[model samples]
Target: MNYRTHIVSDLSEIGQAGWDGLVRAQDKPNPFLSYAFLHALHESGSAAPQTGWQPQYLVLFDGEELAAALPLYVKDHSYGEYVFDWAWADAYQRHGLDYYPKLLSAIPFTPVSGPRLMARDAHARAALVDVLVATQQATEVSSTHLLFPPEEQARQLKEAGFLLRSGVQFHWLNGGYANFEEFLATLEQKKRKNIRAERRKVAQAGVTLRRVRGREATHADWVLFNRCYRNTYRAHHSTPYLNLDFFERIGRDMPDNILLVIAEREGRPIAASLVIHDETTLYGRYWGELEHVPCLHFEAAYYQPLEFCIEQKIAVFEGGAQGEHKMARGFLPTRTWSAHWLAHPSFADAVERFLERESGGIDDYLDELNERTPFRK
Candidate 1:
């Protein structure tokens, strides 16, 4: 099979229909990899060159048919990517080297693990790995990083000479429970009791919660969510990577895949959590509040979304990034994978040794987390 590669700066270069067709063909089709979600990231300027997420998407064409593509980015700074590489950048600076213009492959502002390489078949997938390595060598970049790829894809990256790095995220798996209560019943009594108490705290505070599907969400609802989203970032003394335009674009383009869990006081919205879902999984993305109700964050962000997952028969709910606290709420620690390739030989050797040590730490961490399982044994 003759394969051609095009390093595009825009999704319009390949168009939605073609790109989406390949995403759907993958063994695991996810909403984050969809054209609707990614195109919105760039088109809304949330993940564009201006913000340091310059698109360098690699598309493989087999005689005019879009065979596969990787959502690549040229990042000047690492703000939205949850994978911590600041130490690597600092090390480069200490050596009087530059690391700002590194290459990254990930969904902007989302830490959920899913497909990064949206390929139609093994042939194209293999071709993509080769093209990416060749592209890395030809470019004047410090490193190329692939964050939150599946375990299989990470292994393939390893065979292609990329170093594999492991991390952990909390996720809730369905046990075929008929409802929320039934699901809660599987947890240890202490955990179950604590969760009940937390939910009650929100209710006793006179906060009422409701969910709004994207199609049914009003502009006012989005405005409220953006406020809450920005507030969360502000509280941490940081700027939000996404804006209202980005949320509204995803809402407009992929309404069926979105759900907003909002909390109200006296029929007025005060807090909200945004989650994205498909038939298989629900990804907890963002959340914030105007007033601090005890445990309101868990209610809006975790409990409500967990209930929605059970009701919809969704197989998994990724609780997003790092949160050991999520374990008490019935989430279990799950392993996430990323691959890295440093351009400098000395730096590459150093990182490879560092990753070796980091990998061992992650193994012990997972074992410890398993020993403290929240579920009844």
Candidate 2:
């Protein structure tokens, strides 16, 4: 049994068909994994080496068919990865070791959990895992990390000698809600009242919200969304990881999977949120507002998308990254996983010990979060 390998710097190196075919074969395929979306990230220079995310896509072929593929990158910094490792990097830095240029497999800037290793079967996936380790060793990076991979892949990575780290994000699950009101009705009275109050605040503030599908989103709309996206980052005093070009590319290339919620005041768009969705799930990606309105963020980012989810029967809406506040808005805490492999023995042991303790803390945290569910019993 022989398998061919391709160290793809450009996604087109393996072609869209092969790459997407592998993604489709995976039990969970999302828009972010689709070739168009990833290619856009590369061609637009959003995730380029110059910007710290140098694409190092890995693939394996079995007699002219793609057996496995990993959306790998040589990351110089841990900026876009949602799974934070700044402490680990700092530990290495204090000890005079390089932590940059680490091997990473994740959708850059996107933290929604799903498959990172796209493979036809378990065998191919296992091979991909082995290849990932080989590539890490060959590259001589400090560590190899796969972020937001599903439990199964995380386990596979752990089985192959990787440290598993856990984090939590808020996700709203659909309950066959025929309407937004029906969904809200299931929540505790106080929670339901709070949601209505928030929505009413937006309404009273004369902030009208509209949802635009990507196909219907014009260049002007992209510009508006970009303005809001940048504003959000600026408010945080941080640089926006993605650019207007990346947004436009995805809007052009993967229109069906996009939803842009824009807030209007005096019939002028002031805020916008970008969300990615498939048949069953919606990912809350990015948002920004030019003018702040009370509850406008919730209206544009959370409530509007939840309405879309209810209407479309989308089962899950992942509010990206840490937002314990989301639980108040009906988004419950959910556990997210990342697997890591460190080359340095002492550092690896230290990280392993730390993760063991962290995992237990996460377990307790989840229990506490579950006890605080906003729904009526």
Candidate 3:
């Protein structure tokens, strides 16, 4: 098949329908890969050249029909990408090398694992991989990285000579439970009791949660959600990567995919957690609170989503990124992967070696996490 690659600075150039059509054709379609979610990141100014994430979205065309696409970026820093490469960047700096402006294909600020390459078939996918390497070589970027790609794509990337790095995230898998209590019954006695205690504490504090869908959420709800979202970053003394406009865009464009769990006390909202979902999985994305209510975070961020997943028959609830605490709430450790290719041959070789050792450590860590699973045998 003959394919031509076009690198555009904006997603709108490819148009939502065209881009999303390719995404849906993939084996695993995710909301994060949706045109609205990604375009919102750029159009809302949350991710752009000024913010160190310059869009360099790659699209492949077979005579004007969009064959494949990658949500690529020219990253000047590694802040939002959950896959930590700061040590690699530091090694580059020490050797008088530049790592900034590296090519990255990922959902900005989202650590949830999903498809990074949206292609129709194996032929198109293979062609897309070649285009990625050629783009890195042609642009002369220090390296290219694909974060949170599915396991199959990781294999293709490996075959294409990209180094594979492994990480872990906790996710709750539905076991055909009829309700939240039935799900809890699968957990060990201690973990099950602890979870009950936590929920009881929230209830005793007079904090009630209301799950609001995107379309049902009012403007005031979004404003408060944004405030809570910003407060989360502020508490850590870091700047927020997303803004109100981005949330509003997703709410309007993909209303069915958005769920806001609002925590209220005395009939006044004090906290919020935002979840994004597709037909199969619910993703716990962002959360914050105006008042410190004990166990509120777990309730809004974990349990509520877990209940929603069971009620809606969603297969998985990804607890997001790193959190050992999530294990106590029935989330089990799951492996996530990323692929990399450094332009410098020597450095690439070094990273390959490092990844081999790191891969073993991740394996051992996953083993340990599994041994400590909160669920009953």
Q: Count the backbone clashes (under 3 Å) in each candidate.
A: 0, 0, 0
Q: Which of the predicted structures, 2 or 3, would earn the higher lDDT when compared with the native?
A: 3
lDDT of 1 by residue, 82-193 (tens): 9999999999999999998999999888887778777888888998888999999999999999999999999999999999999999999999899999988999999999
- Write model 3 residue lDDT over 1-377, tens digit each, in one string: 78988999998898888888888888878898888998999999999888999998888999988998888999889999999999999999999999887999999999978788888887888899998887888886899999999998999999988999999998889998999999999999999999999999999999999999888988888899999999988998999999999989999999999999999999898999999998899999999888889899999988898899999999989989999988989888999999999989999999999999999999999999989979898
Q: Cα RMSD to native, each candidate? A: 0.9, 1.0, 1.0
User: Can you write out model 2's per-residue Cα lDDT over 1-377, one digit (the tens) per residue?
Assistant: 56788888987778888888888888878899999888888888888988888888888999999998888898889998878899999999999999987999999888878898888887888888888878788877999999999998899888889999999999999999999999989999999999999999889998888889989999999999899889888998999888889999999989999999989989899999989999988999888999889888888899999999998999999899998989988889888999999999999999999999999999999999999999999
Candidate 2 global lDDT: 0.90
Error (Å) of candidate 2 at residue 270 is: 0.7
lDDT of 2 at 195: 92
Model 2: ten consecutive residues of lowest lDDT: 131-140
User: Measured by TM-score, how close is model 1 to the native structure?
Assistant: 0.98
Considering summed lDDT, which 10 consecutive residues are worst modelled in model 1? 112-121
Model 2: residue 108 alpha-carbon error in angstroms: 0.1
Please give the lDDT score at residue 322 for candidate 3.
Answer: 94
Which ten residues in a row are the worst by lDDT in model 3?
Answer: 132-141
Q: Rate the local accuracy (lDDT) of all candidates.
A: 0.92, 0.90, 0.91
